[model samples]
Target: MPVTTRTVEYPADGLTMVGHLALPAGADRRPAVLIGPEGPGLNDFQRRRADALAELGYVALAFDINGGRWFSDPEEMLAYVMPLLADPDRMREIGHAALDVLRAEPRTDQDRIAAIGYGTGGAIALELGRDGVDLRAIGTINAVTTGRPGEAAHIRCPVWAAVGSEDPIMPPAQREAFTAEMQEAGVDWRLVVYGGAQHAFHHPTVDHTVLPGVAYHARHAERAWHDVVGLLDECLPVVSPA
Candidate 1:
């Protein structure tokens, strides 16, 4: 069987949002994986990841965070993403819009859905889990910003977060806060910190990054992706071809 891809555009928050959908070559409904990219929005890296997941028989959607726009400048990206991070409601709106698109697809098995996000997109995935979106697994990398204690109580799925030991954006204290919040919420959660890696370690392309705290580490990136796939397999295993 082969993998296939398509473009899905939808109206969101008065802006035309775009996403890349990857479908496995099968007739059976597959477990869906929603990918939220870094603050730079969806790009080739995220789309490639989606396609890889689809090759493993998961229907994957790489959704946009900034109306299909990406920023090469760190200040500009933060200026756009910081406000959304501060507003949990807005993040949930963006996430739910993407979720709706994934669930509407014929190949997606709505009952078994997982989300993986990087940087700002990771926060959006976490926000969706906090809003009780009924996801099976939530995997985040370099974006372990904790939600309000009360809001975290709504998360019913398992969460797996990975970060670099030296990443300033999500330092040790922030990671502790996120773990504590997840513990208090009684959510099944796991966190991994890789040594010698920086923020956005999973990013393969360095040209898109221009931040002081962000760098790409190939080894850690591969390990983090494997860990995320393991989480999804444990919580939302896809059916094999018949």
Candidate 2:
């Protein structure tokens, strides 16, 4: 399927966030998926994912919360994202701005919208859910959560989370705690752990074996992609032709 790409403007934090929107062929209004990128800003991998989602019949909006920037070093990335993550209100505003942009697109069915995020972006998605975004579903890949214990309870949409078993940052213990918290919050949530995978496994930038200290499993990455698409299908069904 062919895809169409366009730029969108979202105003927040006294700055304009420029995002990429991708739509599938035909004149149909499709369910939209708001995709949040990992760290700094949107990258090629995210843009490719947006195109892939468009091919799957969704109007995919790849959001730019970081105002179009990239940081190669881990410390530098953390330095840039930590403050934003710490301020829940700021995160919520940014998320709402992106959601607004997605919901406004003529090709998107605002009522059937969903969101998926990666890493820090994943955290933002969770915050959006906490703030009651009226979404169909939300998914996070290798995401981190910092809200209160019972915060997820109020979310009306189903939540799905995927993590790497070998990820040192989000280890088994943290994942277990997060699952327990979700259960206590009465959230309809599923947690999947990809065995032998590490943080950012889905990122194409991570090599298979060269990063000695980090583990990256390709099999898990491929499976995770399919899993995300399947989840979206379940949450945001395609409207039939009249």
Top model by TM-score, which number? 1
Q: What is the lDDT of candidate 1?
A: 0.90
TM-score of each: 0.97, 0.92
- Tens digit per residue, CA lDDT, model 1, 152-211: 888889899999999998999999999999999998988999999988888875665478
Instruction: Assess each prediction's global lDDT (C-alpha) against the native.
Output: 0.90, 0.83
| The best candidate in terms of lDDT | 1
User: How well is each residue in 163-203 modelled by candidate 2, as lDDT tens digits?
Assistant: 98888878877888878777888889999988888888887
Candidate 1 at 12: error in angstroms?
A: 1.8
Q: lDDT (0-100) at residue 137 of candidate 1?
A: 89
Q: Which stretches of candidate 1 lie over 4 Å from their true place?
A: none
Candidate 2's C-alpha runs over 4 A off are 206-215, 240-242
